[model samples]
Target: MKLKLRIWRQSSADAKGRMVSYELDDVSEDASFLEMLDVLNERLIAEGDDPVAFDHDCREGICGACSLVIDGQPHGPQAATTTCQLHMRKFKDGDSIDIEPWRAGAFPVIKDLVVDRSAFDRIIQAGGYISAPTGTAPDAHAVPIPKQDADAAFSAAACIGCGACVAACPNGSGMLFMGAKVAHLGLTPQGQPERATRVLGMVAAHDEAGFGGCTNTGECAAACPKEIGLDVIGRLNADFRKAAIRAA
Candidate 1:
């Protein structure tokens, strides 16, 4: 298949960016989106031109590194799909595709399609873990977490922190990502001890990192590759309110 790509090009964080167009022929329908880019880079490199840069790892979609907005959709037009898992077949011949990095102030582009997502790491460090030590792996039935709570916790934990939530949000809020981390722990009995502090610290870090506040537009959950629900954000807000009151 033949295709046209309009990609954002920026050499550095401070460099100006613009869409540059290129055309390619003989693309395989089975080729994953990243593989298509690889083909384009190969041709550019063979001509001594700087290859387009994009983030990718574990192309099977486990790693959220393949962050991109394809044709105005995060991870292409497919619902609940990551860019690495998107296929050329999803497009038609002669289609013009616009590829851009995750657009959010908290996730500034480092170059080409890569953005600095260390803001997520900072939020995690703030309080995404249970500091209480479990010296060794416990018996499978030791804690006996309610199946309902366990399922909810597992669902929340599915979040891959891809920043698609932020990219899709009109306000650039990361509440979906932040809420997932909070709910993942909060739903589990082991996470109770730090529940209050976890919500407080993470929310503080989230704001400090320049992420916007959630306003219930629901775009974050819709764009989530993991299908993390806006319900997690509700849980986050509930926890935050309780935490704030407790602190007072």
Candidate 2:
């Protein structure tokens, strides 16, 4: 398949960015999005041109590092799929694809198609962890977590912190990401000890990172590659309320 890519190119964070067009011929339909880019970069290098820069690791969709806004959608037109998992078959021959980085204040562009996502790491570090003692592994069934809570926690834990939620939101909210982190621990017995503090700390960190507040627009969940539900946001709100009241 052939494609025309209109990709954003910026020399640095302070550099002005604009779309630069390139044509690719003989691209395999089976090529994953990042693989196609590899082909393109190889061609650019052979031609003595500066290759486009993008992020990718564990292209099986586990890493969430291959962030791309394709054709105006956060990971292309697919639902519940990350850019690394997106295939070239999604586009037709001669298609013009527009690619950009995640656009949010919290995710400032470092260069072409690469943004600094350390804000997410900061938010997680703020409190997205259990306060359990450091020791040898405990027995799986030692604390008997209810099946429902276990399932909910697993669902929330599916989030990969891709920042697509913020890119897709009109307000650029990190609520969905924050909510998933909170719910992942809040529903588990090992997390209960720090539940109150975790929610408060993570939410505050999210705000401090320049992410906007949640308005219940549901765009975050819709654009989420993991299909993590807005219900996690509700859980986050409830947990935050409880934490605030206790602190009062």
lDDT of 1 by residue, 1-248 (tens): 99999999998899999999999999999999999999999999999989999999899888788999999888889999999999999999999999999999999999999999999999999999997665888888989899999999999999988999999999999999999999999999899999999999999999999999889999999999999999999999999999999999
In model 1, which residue pairs have backbone atoms overlapping below 3 Å? none
What local distance difference test score does each model get?
0.94, 0.93
List, residue by residue over 1-248, the lDDT tens digit for candidate 2. 88999999998999999999999999999999999999999999999999999989999888889899998899989899999999988889989999999999999999999999999999989998877678898989999988999999999999998899999998999999999999989898789889998998998899999999889999888899999999999999999999999999
TM-score of candidate 2 on Cα atoms, chains taken together: 0.98
| Candidate 2 CA-lDDT value | 0.93
CA displacement after TM-score superposition, residue 152 of candidate 1 (Å): 0.6
TM-score, every prediction: 0.99, 0.98
